[model samples]
Structure formats: C-alpha cells, structure tokens
Target chain A: MNLKNIFKKDNIMPVAVLGIICLVVAVLVAGINLITRDVIKAEEDRKISESLSIVMEGGEFEKAELPSDAPSTVTAVYREKNGKGNVVTLTKQGYKAPISITVGIDAEGKITGAVITSQAESHGKTGIDSYVSGFIGSDAAGVESHFSANHVTGATVTSEKIKEAIYDAFVVLGLAAAKDTPDVPEFTPAGEASLTESEAIAIAKELMDGSYTKVALPENMPETTHALYKRQEGGYAIHLATQRIKWSPTENEAIVTVDGLGNITGIKMIQWNVGYDKELLSAAPVCTEEYLNSFIGKNASSLNRVEIVTNATLTNNFFGEALKGALDVLYPVPIYSIIAIVIIALAIAAPVAVVIINKVRRKKNEAK
Target chain B: MKQNNKLSIFLRGLIAENPVLVLVLGTCPTLAQTGSVIAALSMGIAATIVLACSNVVISALRKVIPDTVRIPCYIVVIAGFVTAVQLLMHAYLPDLYAMMGVYLALIVVNCIILGRAEMFARKNNMLDSLLDGLGMGVGFLLALLAMATIREVLGAGTFAGIAIPFLVGEGYSYTIPILTQAPGGFLVFGILIAIVNKIGPKKGEKKRKEFSCEGCPSAHLCGKVSCAENTELVITSEPEVQGTPEGKEGEA
Candidate 1:
C-alpha cells in the first residue's frame, strides 16, 4: 500500500473530523465529571446523614462496618457517636418495588424508630407512617407479633417488607437474640385442625340458638369441612377451612351455623393466618362481617343467590361448595334411596350411552 | 436561504416555529415531563442548556466538520453537553436531577436540538445560531409550561404542588387522573398543535414549508425541491459564506 493512498484526503478527512469531535466531547465530559465529583459525593453524604438523623435522632453518625451475617437486604449501617443506637438502612423487595427503610436499634436490642426513606409501594407512601412507627419500643419478638397482627390495610406487602428490613436491622446489631428466627422463616400451611374445640364452641354459641355437642363430619363431606357441632335446639355449627389467598399457604378458618332445615343462620371468621403478606386478604371487599352475614338464611341450593365479592370470587365459590357438602352431611340421603336413584338414572341413560359407544366404535372400524 | 435579523430569528422560534407545538419536535420529553410543573420546568431548563451549548459549539466547528461525518459529530457534541448538564444538575440541584431521571440524559437524542443544529447552527453565523438555540429553548420551555399547567391543574388538582381550593374541597376531591397519563399527553399535544395552527400567522406556514426541505439533513443527497412533490429536481449548493474551503464535499 502506498503511503499517499493511506493518508488520502477522502479517507482521512471524515476520520479526522469524527476523531476530533469524539476527543473534544470526551474531554468536555471528563472535565464536567472532575468538577462535579466532590459536589455529588457531598450531596449524597448529606442526604444519608439527614436520613440517619430522622431514624436515630440527636446523634452524629459515622458509617459503620456491616456485620458478616447481616441479611442481604441490609444496605448500610451507621453508628451513633454517643452510643445511642445504630441506624441500619436496608432495601427489601415489596409487592411492586424495593422498600428502602432506616431502622434505629438501641443497645438493649429494642427498636427506637423506623422510617421509610423511599419506596414505590403499590398504595404509595401515605398511611404507612403509623405502621412503621408501631415498631418503636419493640424487641424482635414484639416486632414479629405486632407484624403478624397488624399492617397498613391496603399496603400489607410493603408493610411486611418494611418489617423484614427492621427486623434484619435488629439482627445486624446482634439484637435478634430475643427470639431465634430465621432470616426468612418457613411459612407453614395452616391446617384444618387450627380451629380449637373451645373456639368452635364459642363461635357456635354466638350463632346457634342453644347448646351443641361436637359430632363427626359426615363421610361424604368435602375435605375443607373440618368438624360439625350438632345443636340440641335443632341446628349444627360447621367449621370450614379456606386458604387466605389461593397463592398463600396461610388459611382462613370460618364457622358456618345452620338450622335443622340446613338454612345458614350465621357465619363468622374464626382465624386468618397472616404469615404470607397477601394484601388481597385484607383488601378483599368480602372479608367483612356484613359480607359473612349475607350468607345467612341461605341453604346449599340458595347459597348461589348471594352476591359475590369482586376479587374474592374463588373463595366465595369455595364457601358455596363447602356449605353444600356440610348440608349433604346434615341431610344424609339413605343408602338404599341413593342406590335406587342411581339405577333409575342408569336405566334412562342406557340407550343414549349405547348409541354414543356404537358411533365411536363404527368410526374406529371405518378408519381401520 | 434568506437571512433574517437577530430579533426576527430569535422571535420566530417562540410562536411561529415553536419546537413542540408548531414544529412538533421533542414530543417524548414534552409529554413525559409536562405531567408536573416542576418536572416540566426542570426538563425544559436542562434541555435548553444542552441545546444552546451544543448549538454554539456545532456552529463554531461547522466548517471544520466533514459533511459525510456530520451526524455522528453532532451526536457526540450534543451527548457531551447533555452529560455535562446531567453532572451539574446531579451536583447542584440533586432533587431536580432525581425528578428528571433518564429524561435529562435523553436530551442527546431530542430531535429539536439536532434539528436546530442542522438547519440553523451549521449554516448561520455563530451569533444567529446562539439566538436561534435560545429562542427555540425558550419556546420549548413555554410550551412545556403551558401543557404542564393544564395537566397539573386539571389532572392532579394542584399547581406545582399547591392544591387548588375549588378543585379539591373538604368532602370531595375532583380530578381527571387520565389527563396525567399517556393518552392525555397525546390529546393535549394534538389540541395545542391544532390551536397553534388555527391562530398562527399565515406567513409562518409558508416559511415552515420552505424550511422543511431546505433544512433537511438529506437534502444534499436527494437533490429534491420538496418532499411531497418528487417531480421537481433541484441542485444542492454549498454555503456562499467567505473562507469555506472549496472541493471539501468532493473529498467527503
């Protein structure tokens, strides 16, 4: 290749122009970065410091080394200069986005405060302040119990995430010794046996007309039908189990009381397992006394006439099936009567069954 | 292209050749940011700074840049200015920087900036290019403010975070949430464009059509008089300014 051809004007001009423009841009960008690097760092430091002050007040904080066994959600830990507490910043995955919170844990392993610094929760940041503030003065066990019982009504998932972050903060500070729980606890599926005998009787006494005795569930009853209580005044209280949400292991136990005629007298929610933070459980329009009351005066056949909740359609359908099974157990069709009915049905369908079988057999023969 | 005075060149972009409404450029940021007044204001300012800076630099280096490599060169310069603005905003105005998010960096790809650079900056004098950039920037800001005012007031029942008393009262709060959404952005953009068309000076329409072909980046290649009328062929000419090196196009 000739040197003249290598450095030809056509070949060189475009390259030169592009090269110069790129070089100039790179330099300008570098210069801006150089100028802004310190300002940006200082600004970030100021923000972190402000957030730290919000969580653990009246302390000059300095960044501390995070514990080796700290939960993955724990992002940063800052120690108070006067030994007040440590503020642990963590970001846990919420329903929609990562919920970032700073939790303040004192030397005695009790939470002083927890503030949500940033989150893109489904229900937004409003109304969650009280939920987070409830963590104040709680040790690890208290935190767990409080979290298990209460949450921001519609933002349950976000609230649960914030609770996890706060609890992890306690664990990071070696404050979780109050209760030995795993970083992520195993969610046990709520069993049908969760409803106690006394609790069943208490619910029965509230709904039924008089005293009742625990009785065996009829043989053909649905799996969800736990136990039946026969009323002395001519009715029965049925204990039924349903999942709190279809996707969750946690179950909701409900008590449905029926008169001797199998007409539902009253229904009550017995136990709502809140292990898995299913917002739909709390946000459901049907999970109310009024809704449960609507099921009253309806028998197995009449249950379908009850209006269904918009989101809890599957649960409603399950309730209907459970009630039908309970009623079947109450009104046991005689074995002889069932056998006679089956024979009569078979006698009516015998000709149609033969014709369908013949048609299928003829088609197979034709193909062969 | 005819030369206009500094004032006319600057004033034209405000209403006649308004980048968002009249010319319909930079629709993404206009729609995305105009959902809130603060966001729209921040976006407008950030884009304006980048546009003005890039225009001046591109104009100053126009003669030095080879025609074949101009687009890439323009992008580099524009990106550099955008990054610089981003860094500055991150440092000095962190809140606004966080609010603007990726839209600030996206100014590099905004058609309005590249359009002005190609049409006015590369051809006009440095002063005129600077004025054109400023005028277009201000026009963009004004357009964003107009759209944002409507969106923030009606959609959110607030003006720059302050609640409007009549819109949101004690027992009831009234708001059309869809106005802050994507469809609403298109609706508002179309209405504004239609309004600008209805009230705009007739002379601006003719000037707009003339500049459409003359300022097109691909005008040199196609040698066309108009985009719509393919029958008319025209000769592409070099800048008649002094000291422009001859035969640079041939080399390119």
Candidate 2:
C-alpha cells in the first residue's frame, strides 16, 4: 500500500472527523471533571462529619491520621474536639452486604454510643434497636460476650456483624484483648421474648384506668380466642387480644378498651411479629402509638368504617377485627340474628306476592 | 426532505417512538434503578440531560462527520455528555449519584442516546434533534416513574420512601414483595409497553420497502457481492442510458 494513498482524501476524511470529535468530547469531559472534583470531596467530608456527630453525641470532629498498621476495617478515625472520645468508622462483612458503623469509644475505652452509618444487613432496624443498644454502656472487653448473650434472636447474623465492627473499633483504640481472639461467641438465646403475656396485660392496664380488675371469662362470652386479659371496671370491660391478619403469617396483639356504652375508648398494639423479609418488614408500617390512638371514640361496630392507613391497610384491618371481636363479646350486637330475621321476612313475602300476581293474571285472561 | 413541525418533532418521542416502552431500548438501567421511586427519578433526569446535550452536539457536527466513522463519532459525543452528567450529579446530588450506582455511568451505552443520534440527529437540524432528544428523555422518565410507582407501592409500600398510611399498619399484610425484585421489573415493563401499544399510534402505518443494505450506514464502502453488483450496474448503465436519446423519445 502506498503511504500517500493512505493519507489521501477518501481515507483521511473519516479519520480526521473521528479524531476531532474525540478530541472535543475529551476536552468537554475534562473541563466538567475539574469543576466538580472539589465539590465531590466536600460532600464526602460532610457525610463523615454528620455520621461522626450521630455516633459521638454531637461534637466538633477533627480528622485523625490512621496508623500505617491499622486493620482494614478501620476506614477513618476522628478525634472529638472536647477530648471526650474518638469516633471510629468501620466496615465489616454483613450477612448480605458490608455493614458500616460509626462507634464512639471514650478515652477510658467504654463505648459511648454506636450508630449504623450504612449497612446492607437484611433486618438492620431490629438489630440496631435491640442488639446494638446493648453496647451503649458496655466496656470494650465486654462487647463480644454482651453481643453473644443478647443478640437479636431472628437477626443473629446482623447482630454478630455489628459486634465485629465494634470489636474492630476496640482494636483501633488498643483496647482489645488479643488479635486472634474470636469476636462473637456461639451462644444463642433460647426462645427470645419478643412480647410476653404479662407484658400485654401491663399494657392493657395502662390504657385502662387504675380501677380495672382482671376477671375470668363471663358465661355469655365463651367464644373469644386469644384473649390474654379481661378487666371490668365501672360496668365497662377492657379486653386485650392477639389476632392474626388474614393472609399474613404474622400476628398483631392489641389491647382494646371499651366504655359502658359499647364505645371503644382506646386501642394499643402490645406486640407484633412483622415478617423477617427485609423489604416487606421495611415497607410494613409499625403500629405506632399515634396510629392506635386514632381508633379511640369509634363504636366497635364502626371499627371497619375508620380511615385506613395507606400502606398499613392490612395491619389497620387486623386492628379493626381484634377490636370488633372484643366489642362483640361485650355488646353482642347479634348480627347473625338480624340476618336470619331478614331472610325469614323475605321468604314469607315472596309467596304472597306471587299469589297476588297469579290472581291478577287470571282476571286479565278472563276479560280477554 | 420535508421539515417536521416543531411540536410534532418534540411530541413524537413521547409516544410514537418512546425509547423505553415503545422502542424497547435501554432495559438494563430501567430494570435496575426502578426498585425505588427516588432512584428511578434520579436516573431519568440524569439520562435525559445526557441525551438532550449529546443530541444537540451531534446534530451540530453532523456536516463534519464522515459516514464511514459515524458510529464511533456519535459514541464519543454521547460518552462525553454521560461523563459530564455523572460528575455533576456526583458533586451536587451525591446521594442520588450513590444510589444510582453503575447505572449512571452505564448511560453512555444506553441505546436511546445513540439510536437517536444515528436515526434522527445525523440527518436533521440541531433544533429538531434537540427537541427529539428532550421528547424521548421525557418519555423514558414517564415510563420509569410508572414502573417505579407500582413496584414501590406494592413491593415496598412506600411512594418515594413516604409511607402510604392505608397500605401500612399493625394488621395490614397485603404487600407483594416480588414487585420490587427483577422479575417484577420485567412484568411491569411488559405491561406498560402493552398499554402504550394499545393507546398510541397504530404500528406499520408508514410502510417503507426495506433492503438488506438499509441497516448499513456506509453501504457505499461495503465490499459485499450485493453492494458491488448494485454499484457496478449503476456505473455501467449510466453512459448507455445517456447515449440512447431515441429510446427516451419513443415514449414521448
């Protein structure tokens, strides 16, 4: 091939066009990158500051250089301005994804507080609320055993992973016992108490007045199931019951308070087992105090008529049924009796109407 | 070529040639980012900015681009816009950038941007191409929002992370978790496409005779037998056709 022909009009046109376009695009991208570099860095710095404040109880943070031999889990260390503690950010392998926790360890090596900055653990909320809370007043040496003894039963993996992060913080502060020591023990709590029967009774007592007294099932109310507590005071009875929502595997236990006039005074969720599925659990609205308070002032018969929470429809519906069941035992509306009477009336009216129609038809036929 | 009206040029991409639902382009990002309403919305805006910017630049340089190297030229321009958008999002909306993950960078290869460049921007004026890109971008955003709404509402029971009061509560357990997963993404995408197909313009209305070489942008440079034969026939017949004036006059 001739070198001159290679650079001729036919070939060079395409090559030059592509080269110019590439050059222009590269210049444009480079210009944008230069402008955004500092801003991006600042944003990351702000996130670190926020996480530090949350875990360290709101104090100014100055970045501290990590020792060269620091463990890989210790991503960054920040010293508190008041000299109270050091906030250590650590990343540990969770059950599904990496769990990042910012832990504040005081100068004396006691954990001040710990907050999960970012985590991919499936049941993180329950773990954070229950197991991670156990670390607040514990020393660095006691973290492993405390976690092993009080791990959130259903969220064992997540609890253990959080413990690993806390242990990594211990290593950073030079408070750990030994490098090769196991972080989490194999002990698991047998039959963890999510909610106990006595706890449900206590919640009912709080919702009702102090004068309420627990009573055995009355002769007229034998059909009520899951009724943990039945209290009667001033001609009113408050019943606390647990009812499973239809189509849901979990059950919601609630206390329903009723007045003498068959009106629901209050309702409260004592305990609930929303499923272990992460997406479903996060999406399922917790039966909060404000939500249960909305059921007050409505008659038991009108429980289904209340406004349903948008995403918590099934939970709200379950609360309604539980309240309705409790009210049925007290008021005995006799919905079945009303239905039977209506059917009997319809059965008698149908034959009489048919006879009158036949007599009119005979008269018309005779005239014709 | 007859110039399209400004409104029709902008509106056509919204329904007639929708990049996501109608044309079935850019399914990777559509499925991945649509697990949440916020993620889907962020991806849509980011992609739209890139698409519109790339279309305008490509159309402006259309005259300078040689046909043989058009695809590479278009890709470079598209990738530049994508990188710029990614950097800007990272700097300003860092949370959204983190949430979108790989899909934001993946916009460079998203077929909608390049497809518009090749099929419309390369042949059209800068203004028309800009409008086409905007319309297609908006169409893509709408399709994503529709899917995200269904998935987030049914699967996660939240609209943009704000819980819907009716769908959630202690005793309410009717959420279908599968809608937020990958299979749900495909199901919602297919349903949206079907709905668009039923309501939008009828298919096959403009019938063009498609030859095999139609898909090759540089058909003149192709060394295939069919291309060579066609070119040779045209070259050999031209002089004879010009010399035979009596043959043309017989019809007159």
Candidate 3:
C-alpha cells in the first residue's frame, strides 16, 4: 500500500496519540537543557570572579581588557587612591589575585592616598591584607624594582598567586609597578635568632654607618644593603636598603625616603605586620593591641618575660615566633610546619570520602 | 482452520492465546524487562502499542495482499509499528529508554506482536482481530507487571525503586550488590516467574477455558462456546447472518 494510505480516516486515532507523545518528550528535554545552561554560566562566573577580585585594587573594581602584547599574568587595569589621599595608581600582585593598588603619589613619590581599582579576589581580603599593607608610608613609586615584606603567613599560597596577578596586570597596563623577582621574606633568619638588646644596639650602630652592606646577599640578589641612623630622640635606628622600601628597628616598622645624598628626609612606619593597624592599633579578640604595642617601642633587647594572649595562645606564640625571626633572624620553622599540616589535612579528607563510598556499596550488595 | 472461522482464529491465537507464559515465545525480552515494575510497565505498553497498530493495519490491508506472500507482508507491517514504538520511546521517555536499553529495540522480535499479526490479523474479521490483539497485548502487559513486582522486591530489594515503606531504611541502599549483577537478574527472573505461575492462572482451569469458545460458526447453537457464557445470548457465528437457523440448511 502507498504511504498516504496509512493516513486514512480509519487509521487516524493511534497515529494521533503517537504524535502527541513524541511532541511532549521533545519539548521537555530541550526546555530543561536550555534552563541549566544559563545557571551553569553564572556559577562559573561567580567562582572565577571571586579568585580574580583578590588581586584587584581596593574600593571599587572594574574589568578591562589587557593590551594585546601585555607581559606576564597581567589581564586587566585598575585605578585607585593612595595613602597621601591622592590618586596613586599601580598594578601589582601579592599572595593573592592580580590587582591594581592605586595610591596618591606626591612630587617626591610619597604615597598620599590608596585604593584598589580592580581585582579578582574575595571581597575586602587578599594575600596582601598582611603583605602590601606594610607599605603605607613607603613609596617604591619611581623605583622600577626591588621590594620585600614579612610573609602574610596563613595566606602564603594566596599571597604568591596575588603577586603573579599583579605582575600580569602591570604588563597589561604597560607600566612599572614594584618589581621583585621573587621577594620571599627572610622572616626567621636562617640559623640565628634575631638580635638581642645589646646586639640590637650594635646592629643599630652598624646600620647607622651603613656597615650592614657586609652581610652576604642570598646569592643572586641585586644591591641589597641595611643602615641605621640617629633619630631626633637620640636613639639609634635600623633601616633596610632594597630600593626605597625600609624596615626599622626602633619603631615597629619605619620607612625612610632619601634623596640622592642618602640623608633621611621622609620617615614613617606604615603598619607593622606584628604591630597595630595604625598608631592606636586595632584590638583583637585574642591579642590586645596594647599587648602587641608593648613590643613596638622595644626591640630584640629584653626579649624575656612576655606572655601569650589569653584566648589566642597559639596565635600569640606564632606571633612571637614571627617577630623573633624578623628582627633576630630565628630559624625558618613556619614553612615546614605549614606544608606538613596541609598534607595531613588533605590525607584525612581523602580517606573519609573513600570510606563513605565503599561502605555504601558494600551495604547495598549485602542486602540482596 | 477455515480462513472465515473467527472463533477458532481468535482463541487459537489468544489462549493457545497467550504470547508469553504458554508459548514462551517472547522470553528474551520478557526475562530482561521483568526485573523492574516500571520497565515491565513501559515495555508492556510499548508492545501493546505496536500490537494494536500492527493488527489494525494488517486487518485493514488483509484482502489486498496475496496469500503466498502474506506472512512476509504481515511481518513488515508489524516491524513498521515496532519501529514507531522504538522512536517514540527514544525521543519522549528517555529515562525509560535507558531503563529498557536494548530490550526496547528488541520489541520487533517480541513474537506476540508478529504472532498475533500473522495468526489473527491476516485471517480474521477486522473488528475481531483488533479486539484479539488488544486482549492479548493487555494480557502480556499484565503478566510482565506481575513478574516485575516479584523480581523488583526479593531480588533487587526494591519495590520499583520506591522503598517499600515497611521495609524502609533496612534494604534501601544506593547499590544493589547482588541484583545489579547478571546471574542475579536471571535467578530473580526465574523466581518471579515461578511466583507468578503459582499465584497466577491454575494450569487445569486454563486448559478448560482454553477451548470453550467457538462463537462465530453457530453462535446460537454453540451456546456455551459463545464468550458471553452467562446468557443464552444468541450471537451469530457469522455476524452478517441474522438468526443463523434460517441460513443453516443451505450450507448443511
């Protein structure tokens, strides 16, 4: 029989039923897939955006395309204010995502105001929370390269990732931001503890006369030096000489800007990784700002008779360990400790998931 | 059997009739799908879909085909409807498509669809053949559901994957260690068939109903043989002839 014969008035009912079923199933499958597509895209965007924000400039952030020939990991540009309250824009990376930390730089290149124009990171937090904040009063503005800061600790991996992002952003913007080929901090000196009272005084004297240049560099470093100078109070000072960035012994941390003659002109302590957020210091639930401030006026001298925080005892111990290493050159114990902890935690999670899966399988089988 | 004999035609196909349990014809697909109630359900429905359509088409086109080539012609018609059922399952109920897997495509070989088409559809009255195909299709589906219920419970520890609330939490598990395997599928299939066989039609009673009907030849004289057994319902053996005794002597 011909194909059209199948569609006769006598054969209509069954064919109509089949056609309806097919139409419903086709529409349902297509509709469900279409809805999930946008949901999946949004989820992806949220996750990636969170990571990128960590390295963005402070305040408001914007996403912009990097130039075609940009170098490194730079992907976007950002603008923001600096410490002096003026608009100082620079792109850099720390332990987190790539971000442009814009601060106001004056004629002398001192930071006036600071802001983060853009980043890919969690809101209000990045690897720089404890790293770049160390540069409040410092201006490495005109300086092409060279910088260092104490490890932001607990956020080490994130900090390193941030540094890479900053470099990428710098390349995209085609501008010079702080350049350090891997500015890993020597928080705890290799072998010895930091300087003692008498030792601190002696190192201070050496630094004042610029005798710290005698210390051997970490092999391939570029022109590293240290110095001490007399403050107005007649007490000695400690200074670091890796470009314009400075680390002082008298204050928790101090920045000294010298023009050509190497005479100290502008000096300020932005914030101490171990000290308060500012001159007044922010109080913490575990460690009081007052307790942390006690160490601000004192150096490696009289390092005895201190107590850990009441609630945050371990944090206190860690804080002391960080300080002991930074000023005294204590042993580098934190790195080994962190690596061991991470491995153990991951090992625990893996076995737990496997055991759950295996148990579910075994129980199901046993039932039958 | 006379080509015109409707009762012998419908009964021989329907009772001798049964597609699955008696002839054991569609056993491959029967055993495969009887593991779950839903698979059995959809398979039964899909088969019924093909059977009913094929029978109707064959019945409609019965006179158009040459007798020498009729079996082949009927098989082609049956296969076409089976293809339609397969495509319908794949596009609409994809989950059921996965559940039935290869078995759904194997509806072409279900024998019940083709057997009825050849035995009933090719020889009988269009209306009678269509009814027989429907009755048999319904019977096969009912049998599949019955077998599926038992297999899904004892073997898979599931009553169609909806946890049997009273047996809840105890046997409810993501993995079915034994039933998930092949040997288990076979063992469960056999045990379920045994249960359905036990609780199902008594073999002796089945042999009795098996031959009782011969409604069409002399429906009035063949009183008890007429399917509407309770009444002295004088149905014509030949529906075209009214009050059959008037026409009886001419042939006699």
Winning model by DockQ? 1
| Better candidate by DockQ, 1 or 2 | 1
Task: Summarize candidate 3's per-residue lDDT along A1-368 as a digit string, tens digits.
Answer: 23344355545644444454345445654565465556544543453344333433243444445556555454334332332122323445533344545433333444333344434332222234445544444444422232432344444454555444433333344444434433543232222223333444454443343322223333322222233334333333433332112222222233232222222233333223433323322345333445545554333333333554443332343334333333333212333445678999989999987866765666566656
Q: Which regions of candidate 3 are displaced past 4 Å?
A: A1-368, B1-16, B168-181, B188-252
How would you encode candidate 3's per-residue C-alpha lDDT over B1-252 as one tens digit per residue? 554555454454344446676556687777767767887898888888778777887787777665655666665566566655655554455456546655666777777877887877888767777777777887788767776776677555677778665444664544344553346656665675565456655665566545444334544554342243332233444443354443332433
Query: By lDDT, is 2 or 3 better?
Result: 2
TM-score of chain A of each: 0.39, 0.37, 0.23
Which lDDT value does model 3 have at B49?
77
List DockQ, one per candidate, in order.
Answer: 0.26, 0.24, 0.01
Lowest summed-lDDT stretch of 10 residues in model 3 chain A? A243-252
TM-score per model (chain B): 0.78, 0.78, 0.66
Candidate 2 residue lDDT tens string, B1-252: 345588888888787888888899999889978888998899898888888888898899899888899999988888888888888987887777667755787898999989999999989999999999899999899888989999999987899998888887677856788897779889888898888877876553322214444454654454454443432322222333333344333532
Instruction: Tell me each candidate's TM-score.
Output: 0.52, 0.51, 0.32
Name the DockQ score for candidate 3. Answer: 0.01
True contacts kept of 2: 0.63
As for candidate 1, its clashing pairs are none
Global Cα lDDT for candidate 1: 0.76
Candidate 3 lDDT at A70 equals: 55
lDDT by residue (tens digit), candidate 1, B1-252: 445587888898899899999888999889978888998999898888888888899999999988999999999999988888888988998777766655777798999999999998999778888989999999999999999999889998999989999998788779988898768888888898888888985655666667664456665565333442332223336332212233432332
| Candidate 2, superposed: residue stretches over 4 Å from native | A59-65, A72-75, A79-85, A90-170, A175-368, B1-4, B170-174, B201-252
